[model samples]
Target: MGNVILRYINLMVVTLLILSFFSFSLAYLFPGHPIENLTGIRLENISQIENTEFNYSSGESLLVQYWHYMGSLFDGNWGVSFNSGLPLYDEITNVLPASIELSAYALFISIFVGIPLGFLAAMKHHKLTDYSLLSISVLGYSIPVFWLALLVILIFSLQLGWFPLSGRISLYYEIPDITGFIMLDIFLSDIDNKEAAINNVIRHSILPTFSIALVTTTLIIRITRRSVIETMNTEFIHAAYARGLSGRQVLVQHGIRNALMPIFPLLAMQFTTLLTNAMIVETIFSWPGIGNWLIQAIYHQDYPAIRAGMLAVSALVVIFTMSIDLTIRLMDPKRRRLKRAAI
Candidate 1:
C-alpha cells in the first residue's frame, strides 16, 4: 500500500510537470505582446520595448525565458488579466466554481442515469429495450452540444416556460456570500430564507444542467453498455451463473463492478472534454464561468487570461487523470502488483 501510494504520487508529480510545460509552451506560442496588451501601454519605439523592465529580462535567451516563467509560476504569480484588470488567479477563482458546479452536476446525472440504463440494455441484449436504448445513445452522441443546448432552451425555457433560459441564479434573489456554489450556499445560508434560495438555484440550474447532462448521459450510456456487454460474456460471469448465483447477485456483484472499472478512466477523459465543450453552452446561457471567460479573453486578445485559463484547465485534466489512475491501481490487484513491481 505504501509503495502504491508513493508510485501514485510520483506519477501525479510527473504528469503535473508535463502539463505545466505544455501550458507554458502553448502560452508562449500565443501571438502578440501579452504584457503590452495587459498593461495597455504600448511602446512605439522598438528600443523602448527592449528596454522595458517588466518584459522578460533575465536574459535574452529562450531557455532563460522558460526558466523565468516557471519561476513566476512557483511564486504564485500567474500574471495579470487584460480584460478584468485583475490578477489571473483572482479571475480564475471568480469563475471556476460555476464551471466546477456545472461539471459536477452533469457528471452526477451521467452516472445515475447512464449506469442503470446501460445495465438494463445489456441484460436485455438483442431485445426491444436494448435496441431502443442503443438508438437513443446513438442520437445523443450524434447531436452537437451547442445545438442540443439551444434545442433544450427552446423546449424547456421558451415553449414550456418550465425553466429559466440563462444565468446561474435569478436576479431578484440576494444570496449571502459563502461557498460561491449557489446550491451549497443556499443550503448553508439562513434556514428561514432557504426556500427562495433553493428555488433560485434550481430554477437557474435546470436548463444548463440538463443540456450538459444530456451530452454526458449519451457518452456514458454508450461506454457503459459496451463495457457491461463485454463483461457479461466473460467466462467468470458464466461460471458465476453456473454456480447457482442469483441473477441480481451475478449482475450487481460481478458484472457491474467489472464494467464500471473500465468506465472510470473514460470518465476522467470525458471531464476534460466537457470543460472545452462547455464554452458554447456557457456563451449561449450567459453563465459566468471560465468557458465564457476564455472565449471573451480570446476575442479581446487578453493573453494573460487566456494563458491562465488554459493552464488551469490543463492542470485539472492532469489531476483528474492522475486520480483515475491511482483509483484503478488501488482497486485492481493486478494493477497494484504491477505498480509495486515498477516502484
Candidate 2:
C-alpha cells in the first residue's frame, strides 16, 4: 500500500514537472530570448521566487533559464500582467473560486441527475424512455459546448427571461468576500437581504451551469447505463433477487456500489474536460474566473499571465486526477489484494 502510494506521488511530481515545462516552453515557440520577452517584468522582480536572482547569463543554457522560470511560476513569482500590471498570481487566485464554484455545481448536477436517469434508461431498455435518453445523449455528445452555451443563453437569458445572460452576481448585491465563492459569501455577509443576493448568484449560474452539465450528464448517463446493466446481469444480483431482496435494495445496496467503482477514475478525468469547457463557458458568459482571466491574458498577449494561467490550470487538473487515482487505489478491494501481493 505504501509503495503504491509512493509510486503514485512520484508519478504525480514527474507529471507536474513535465506539464510546467511544457507551459514554460510555449514561450520558445516564437522569437528570441523567451524569458525576457515572455515575462515582460524585470528579471529582478521575479528573482525573489527563490530569493536568488537569475540573470540567465549568456553562457547559461535554455534548461537553466527554464528552471528559473519554473521556480518563479510555481512559487507565484510570476510578476505582473503586461496590460493590467497586477501581480499575476493575485489576479489568478482572486478569480479561481468563481471557476471552482461553477465547476462544482455543474459536476454535482451531472452526477446526481445523470446516474438516476441512466439507471432509468437502462431498466427501460428497448422502450421509448431508453431511446429518448440515448438520443439526447447522442445529441449532447455531438453539440459543441460553446454553441450549446450560446443557445441556452439565447433561450434562458434572452428569450424566456428565466436567467441572467452573464456575470457571477448582480452588481447591486454587495456580498462580502468571506469565502471567495459568491454564494457562500452572500450567506456570510451582513447584507440587507441575503436571499436576494443568493438568488442573483443562482440566476446567473443557471444558463452556464446548464451548458456545462448537459454534456457531462449525457456522458455519465451512458456510462452509468452500461455499468448498471452489467451489474444487474451478474450472478450476485440474481442471488440477491433469489434471496427475496426487493429491486430497490438490490440496486441501491449491491448494484450501485459495484457499478460506481469503475467510473470513479472516469469521473476524475471528466473533471479535467469540465475545466477545459469551463474556460470557453467563462469567456462566453463573462463569468469572473481563471478561465476568463486567461482568455483576457491571451487577447492582450500578456505572456506572463498566459504562462502562469497555463501552469496553474495544468497543475490543478494533474494534481486532482492523481489524487483521485490514489483514493481509488485505497478504496478498491482488487487493488488491496495487488498491494498485498507486492508486499
Best by lDDT: 2
TM-scores, each model vs. reference: 0.90, 0.90
**Which ten-residue region of model 2 has the weakest summed lDDT?**
49-58
lDDT of model 1 at position 52: 61
Q: List the residue pairs that clash in candidate 1.
A: none
Q: How close is candidate 2 to the true structure, as a TM-score?
A: 0.90
- Minimal lDDT window, size 10, model 1: 53-62
Residue 97 Cα positional deviation in candidate 1, in Å, after optimal superposition: 1.1
lDDT of 2 by residue, 1-343 (tens): 7878888888899998898778767777645456555556444554442332244322367788777777776676766789888897888788888888888989999999898999899889889999999999999978999999999888887899888889998888777777788877776778888887778788889888988988999999999899888889999999999999999899889988888888777888888878888888999999999999898888887887887888888888888888987899789977655743552
TM-score of 1: 0.90
For model 1, the local distance difference test gives 0.80
True lDDT of residue 120, candidate 1: 86
The residue ranges of model 2 lying beyond 4 angstroms of the native Cα positions read 39-59, 338-343
- Candidate 1 residue-wise lDDT, 212-329, digit = tens: 8777888888888889989989999999999999989998789878888888878777787677667678988999889999999988888778877888877877787778777776
Give the poorly placed runs of model 1, Cα more than 4 Å off: 1-4, 26-28, 34-38, 45-51, 339-343
